[model samples]
Every structure is written in C-alpha cells, then in structure tokens.
Target: MSDEVKVSDAEALRFHAEGRPGKLAIAPTKPLDTARDLSLAYSPGVAAPCLEIFRDPNLVFDYTSRGNLVAIVSNGTAVLGLGNLGALGAKPVMEGK
Candidate 1:
C-alpha cells in the first residue's frame, strides 16, 4: 500500500469554496435565542464571571472558550503540496479558499 494521498487542485478549490467558504466556523455553545440567553452571554451576567476571573485566572476555562480553542501557528511559507505561497499568497489557502 502506498502512503500517498492525492487531491486535484480543482477538487480542493471546490471543496473549500462550497457552502460557508471555510473549514472552520464559530457558533454560540449556549442557547442564545432568548433575551435571557443574550443577557447571560453579555453585560450584567458576563460581568459577574469577569470579576471572578479577575480574582482567579484559573476560572477562565470555565467562563470562556479558552479550553476549546486550539492554536495553529503558521507563517504560510509552505502549504500542503502547493510549495511556498508566501504569507499574503497563502492567506486564501489558510482561510480555506
């Protein structure tokens, strides 16, 4: 068995360009349909957690998206099978275009 994978440029382009136009999306983890949900997500309700986090930084995981976030550090010098696209040139690739 060969350990190589192949994808046509047109296929890759079509896959990324379809639907939302990106490989990632952000959405509210909690219910935000009601006014109460909105309030709890911001302003008066958010202030309480903010104060708590200020007092103890460890609470960040419980109060925010820090725990679910992942960092992908890349300068865009090299892209998958595309050689060097440079930073600006690679922006589209990074953005899933």
Candidate 2:
C-alpha cells in the first residue's frame, strides 16, 4: 500500500468546512454526564472553585483550562494573500484554516 493518497481541492474544502477550520477541537476537561455533574460544572458546584480563585487568584489555572490555553490575538492586519483585513474581516481566517 502507498504511504499517502491525494485529495482534490474540492474535497479538501469539504473536509475543512465539515470539520473545525483549524482542526482544533475544544472538549470539556471534566465530564458532564449526570445531573450532579451538570450542577457542579455550571452552578452551585462551580461557585466553590470560583470563590477559591477569587481568594487566591492563581487557582484559576488549576481549576480551569487557562493554564493550558493560548489565545490567538491578532490585529487583523497582514493576513496572507488577503492582507490588511483590519480586525473585522480577519476574524474568519484567524485560525489559519
């Protein structure tokens, strides 16, 4: 068998459109299955961690995914091929899809 197969431009576009643009998927770090899990992730159960973070400030990393996250901040200027989108137009391609 060959190590690689080829795809047409149209097929690639279809895959990109159907899946995430950057192929980046964001799933929950914690489970949300039962009613208890739901409450803990959102409401009363979450309050405790919020309080702890408010008290310590640094606990946000431990309780949330912030520690392992990277925000893609851009001015929308200098997008490849379509240059100088100026924030508004640049948002759609910000993920480098």
Candidate 3:
C-alpha cells in the first residue's frame, strides 16, 4: 500500500510499442455498394448539403466533426512531475484525455 507512483522511459516506450496503432480510426457507418449509394454518399446528393453548408457555416457542425472535437496541444517542457519529458512522454495523457 503506497501512494507513490514511478515509471521509467523504457516502460513508456514498451507500452507504446505494445498497442494497436495509436488508438483511433474512422469507419464508414453506412453501406456504399450500389450506384444509388455512391450518388448519395459522394456526388450529386452530397452536394445538396454541401451547398447548404456553403451558405451557412453552422452546418459544418451538422455535416462534420467541427462540433465535438476538442484539441489539446502541449509541450512537456512544463508537464506534470517527471520534469521536462518532452512531447513524446506527454502523449499518453493527451490521447487518454
């Protein structure tokens, strides 16, 4: 039973090496197999919303991830404990958060 926590650079490197590629991915939610699907997903039908969005910037949130994504950028020159570990060491917390 101890409150202290300690980790080394080797351990961090090992953890990163053991994982699936960086953590996130994009996947299409709907089927795009037929000509209709292609039209709807990519060209003529898609342009309907694109035009709407072109007219109103607020539609960017509706048509894309602009509303939900929050980016946190930092350098480890001023990170928690383990002082000045640089950007690489600070990545896990940034991704997790």
Work out the TM-score per prediction: 0.77, 0.66, 0.57
In terms of lDDT, model 3 sits at 0.78
Candidate 1 off by > 4 Å: 80-84, 92-97
Clashes of 1: 0
lDDT by residue (14-87, candidate 2, tens digit) is: 87688556457788878899999999999989999999999999999889988887778788888877888898
State each model's C-alpha RMSD to the native: 2.8, 5.2, 3.9
Ranking by TM-score: 1, 2, 3
Could you tell me the TM-score of candidate 2? 0.66
Model 3 TM = 0.57
Task: Count residue pairs with overlapping backbones in model 3.
Answer: 0
**Tens digit of per-residue lDDT, candidate 3, span 14-52:** 876676745455677568889999898888878987898
Model 1, span 15-96: residue lDDT tens: 8789997678898899999899989999668999999999999999999999987766567767887888778767776665
